[model samples]
Target chain A: MRYETLREQIIALELGRRERQFIPIGLSAIDDALQGGLDLGAMHEVTGPAAVFFTQMILRQKRGGAFWLATSSPNEEYYPPGMAQYGGQPEEVISVCLPDTKDLLKVAYEVLAANVVGCVLLEVQKPLTQTQMRKLQIAVQNTDSLGLVTRGAHTGTTSPERESACGSAITRWYVTVVDWSHEKTQIELYLVKNRRGSPCRWIVEIDHATYDLHLVSVSGE
Target chain B: MQRMICIWFPFLESERLIRQNHDLATRPFALVMREANRAFVSALSRNAGNMGFAPGMSLADVRAAAPDMLYFDADPMRDIRCLQGLLRWASRFTPRVSRGGGHNLYLDIAGASHLFGGEDVLLEKIETQLEDFGFTTRLALADSKAAAWGFTHFGSTKSNITTERLEGAARELPVEALRLSYASTALCQRLGLKKIGELTKLSRVALTSRLGLDGVCRIDRFFGRTAEVTEFARHKKRLIEEEQFFDPLATNAGVEAALERMLEKLCQRLSGMRQGVRKSQLQLDRVDHETMFFSIQLTRPSIDVNLLKRLFLHHFDQIDVGFGIDRLILVAEQVAPLSCHQLSLENSQTQNREQDLEKLINELSNMVGARYVQRFFPVDSHIPERTFSRVAALYASRLEEWQSPSGTRPLRILKKPVSVLLRDGIEKMAPETVFWHGRKCHLTPLSGPERIEPDWWRDDPDWRSGGRDYWWAKADFGALLWLYRVSDEEKTQWFVHGLGS
Candidate 1:
């Protein structure tokens, strides 16, 4: 009886570990660097210009719908038609616009805890505190859902310390516009913090027509 | 075989005023209406009536007789609303409650009276309830609605006349109880007929010749010879659960406990009926005789007790206990049939996930607003701003297929276009550099100017600039911007409409 009980506990642990799967970023180099891809059931933060676009690309990899929570600002409105250009289903996206920062955080927690949607993108103007971040992380940890947070690049945080201040996020990234030509725009993505892998950087080219990102160069090479 | 009950509020307007402001309960108050520049009393309080003040008495005469009496302009609309509320409340006794001409209500309580033991018990209960609600009422029951109305207004304060005695009882009342026109009543008095029994002696042809067919019909209706059609109040079956406390609850915990108990009972009832509540109301009756009400609307029908408790607790702190609550009532104002789904073990997880999503939508909608939580659908329009529209997530049935436009679109669009200044002069095609957001940026056009015109059938203010020539360009900062130029009889102007990533 004691042996049987021990075996059952071991099986349950294995099942729990298996539930935390990773969502591939569609780039083979990035996928290999992160040991498959970004972890589901974990919180990730992305900042700098084109953060929303990158987040939309990552969300398109998931199967189910996503909840987008943002403040009710005219400048922050996402164009559904434009989002569709990146392979996002406009009808499957549930958008919530809240004027209050507190309400935005509360709704973000609720959507994460619901664990029904595949992804949740929260755009917050104010920086979240360590406690708020941990609370949200704890909420999403119970389910196979991904929490994506995007903040303004000018939020008064330096690169190194900003990564350390992320209390519960599994990974932190900063993407900035580098240069552009007639057909493609070049962007630099820095993997500032990765819990399970080494930090890295990449220079990528975005095709305007297809909205696809091409891996141009790695940091070491 | 039909039994009807009529409830008459002799001082409806004054009683309604006193119910709202209890200070005027003992005071002599009157409601006045202006007629030909003269203020005539339309309704009087009990004290004012005892002081020999009657309706139609001019305000000047009443003021002279009782100088301290209070009078205000009558609100007929408010009185009608009060009567309508009472009509709904009276449906507890019988389903068929109809509104009388003014200040009176008729209830068809034929077989429903037995539920309250008998007609006498039902009438007593109605009178006591109305009295508790601060209204002075006179009630009468008879074999017909006309007889009931006649007996309530002209007979005793509380009378139950059976079929054998309905004619005898109505005959003793004045001819005015027949509900005839003023001209017909005057003609009856001119013929020396003061009572209904005196008019019954006249032949039908004689009465019709002297008072017209309308007068004869009124008498026939009063005597139960003619059937009178009445428009009953539309009553919908409601699921209500309430608890009355001997000791008023003063703490938030106590109220929450009571609410939890009521929610459990209500959920059980809904489940048994295969229904769920879409909208619900919570009413708290305080010890001070004041009632507090809170309402909650859901995105979909739900019968989950815990979910309902969480939603109701959102408004629990807003309740001011005042002197404590003596009674709690929960009413499901709207309900819909919800069939049970047979879920397999494998599908149960998926079903629960869907339910969780629905709960999340409802919670977020309640927190922010239903309108703020929405999904986008493509509209059949070419205008950049009119390409899509938002519908509340609760109301959206399914994901609509988004028809992608032929050309590339921006990831984000500005709510209002910001004007951009051109560097150097505008070239024949497109500007080589532009000042956007206070920064000079070089632009390389990757696509031509796709001309889009406004819909001619409708006048849209956003498209008031006439037609637009759109261009997709790569800016110096590596950002792809969507630019539009509008040219009319005036000079050409450029604006940055969207940002592409």
Candidate 2:
């Protein structure tokens, strides 16, 4: 009886199409691939080298309070005041640096579940297992806030294969900085996995003056 | 602006335990004193008072109302010490702070009330800080000390005493507020005189004959006709708050809780003085006559009570409480005036950002070791490693103007450069692939050969190694690596210097 009642509500949201509502990420090609924009009220995993830039992109895309949950990895220190240079209010970003990845994930889940923040950006050194992703996914089920997990390069173990970090995320992205020169900072974003839309790729340019995400080319180009 | 502020602690003897262990803040508690065969309530907690328990009430009546309430023996000496400590704590607000009779404290703000915005704000600050330290207090501000003292004891609890309103407020209180002798009070009551106004209605000469000179004198003091002279103890420039536990605490949790209460009191004292602590000492007195101490030194003066508690909590593991910790004392060893930053209307957002960053830095320092948390400051050195130096995050530098990097640099740089391992067949200069991190480092040099010469003047051990030739490379394995080659007089060496996004 419980499962039936739960399924009926699930069917209800599906019929109403409220479950797929997204706050647009503001670029046509990216938005088209995302089936609208960034999926709302769900966890999305963004990985790779240029993930911080991608993380800050969502900060510019989303308004209101943004919680940046980082770890005490001396190498990967977050300069929140530097966010002001990124054209976002540094005061709006509440940065929390915890001891380990477990605490980081715990804080991320708690913050997302609370639904008090407009956007939560979690940068961790470890990839999320399926269970961890499910826990994070469960947290964002009720709120319209954006939960972005920016997975950094994990340097443990001997396995040559890259950990997919695949979980129950609505979408998974791999960001790579292709060009960071005196002229322009170009990046390649690969949509490795998408729950609703087809996988796609795009090359975007980070504007020098505005720091806005500009789509330079698509997969065909 | 010779404004006098009176702070009345109604339950000084009762709330000591609750102040130390605020867990009992809401629970009903009473201070019982026995005389002959009868027991009486000497003092009650604010919660107990709210339930209609007053000093001098019979213990039988108290237990009949609430049987499960906790009780303690009356300790006037301990209560006086606590009151004196609070009096000393108020010295942070003004130099003219003085101890009053019983549980009251007086602060001669004079011109200083405007320092906290106004008299009302200063009173609110005192009330809030004292309440945080687990005491219920009544506060009032008046032009004269007598009126202020009278207003707190006798005036309506909601009375906000200004000089203009002092006269009316003092009169509205009952004549018992005069603090007359028992016989005098009973005689006045027999005459159907329950208010101060009723006593003052009779001619002075008639009242003198009827109630003696005490009634006239009491009324005189209430009306501010005579000077309310009080000799204040000389101000102590140091802060030391101590608490004695009846039953020794056995756990680090309890020790931390005691330390937390101490920090709250210390911070309140420091906040009043507009000063912050640079170093503090926490001493633990054990039942075995062994005393243990831990010292905390902050990078800057900060009155953040919670942060100080957390910092002391880090050193909690080092303290060994044998048998049990009987008493805990926290002393501010080093303090400096922490002037409030003037808020600008146009730059409020920027200032708030700095404040948030300051709080965040303090929180991080408490969570991690002080050495582990740092903020970046651009150094005046061309050396790749010397371009930026990490300073304690608490003392964040205001100067953020960064000298533009001559070239793009890696965001994540290792503390020490990790040498790049070369495969047997790969060329040193243009190697297509190498080995690192238990995997083949598939290297693709995007930009390279930017030689950085070491500074000659600086005498440093780490930079003793010669200059380095750097490269920005994208590995085929999808990670960006900053590879460098160290130039040695004997032989040139290769190493993977840093990581980039």
Best by TM-score: 1
lDDT of 2 by residue, A136-188 (tens): 87787777788998767524231212535346877888777777653456778
Runs of candidate 1 with Cα error greater than 4 angstroms are A1-20, A152-168, A177-186, A206-213, A219-221, B1-96, B99-217, B223-235, B286-292, B317-323, B342-349, B426-435, B438-442
Show where candidate 2 strays beyond 4 Å. Answer: A1-26, A32-44, A49-123, A129-150, A154-171, A177-182, A193-199, A206-217, B1-237, B250-279, B288-323, B341-357, B421-429, B459-467, B486-492
lDDT per residue as tens, model 2, B1-501: 457888898877767887678788778899989999999999888788888878899999989989998888888888889988998899878888888787889889887877888877788888889888878888777766767777788775524677677666666677677777788889989998887777777899998988788767866776667666767779545699999999999999998888878888888888888899888888899999899877766656889888788778766767787799999988999898885679799988757755654554454455454555455566666676676666655555445645455655655556666665666443467545667667776677777788887778878676677677788777664566777776565755666666653
Please state the error at residue A90 of candidate 1 in Å.
2.1
| lDDT at A198, model 1 | 71
Candidate 2 residue B391 Cα shift, in angstroms, is: 1.6
Model 1 DockQ class:
acceptable
Q: Candidate 1: deviation at residue B379, Å?
A: 2.0
lDDT leader = 1
**Residue range with the least summed lDDT across 10 consecutive positions in model 1 chain B:** B472-481
lDDT of 2 at A15: 28
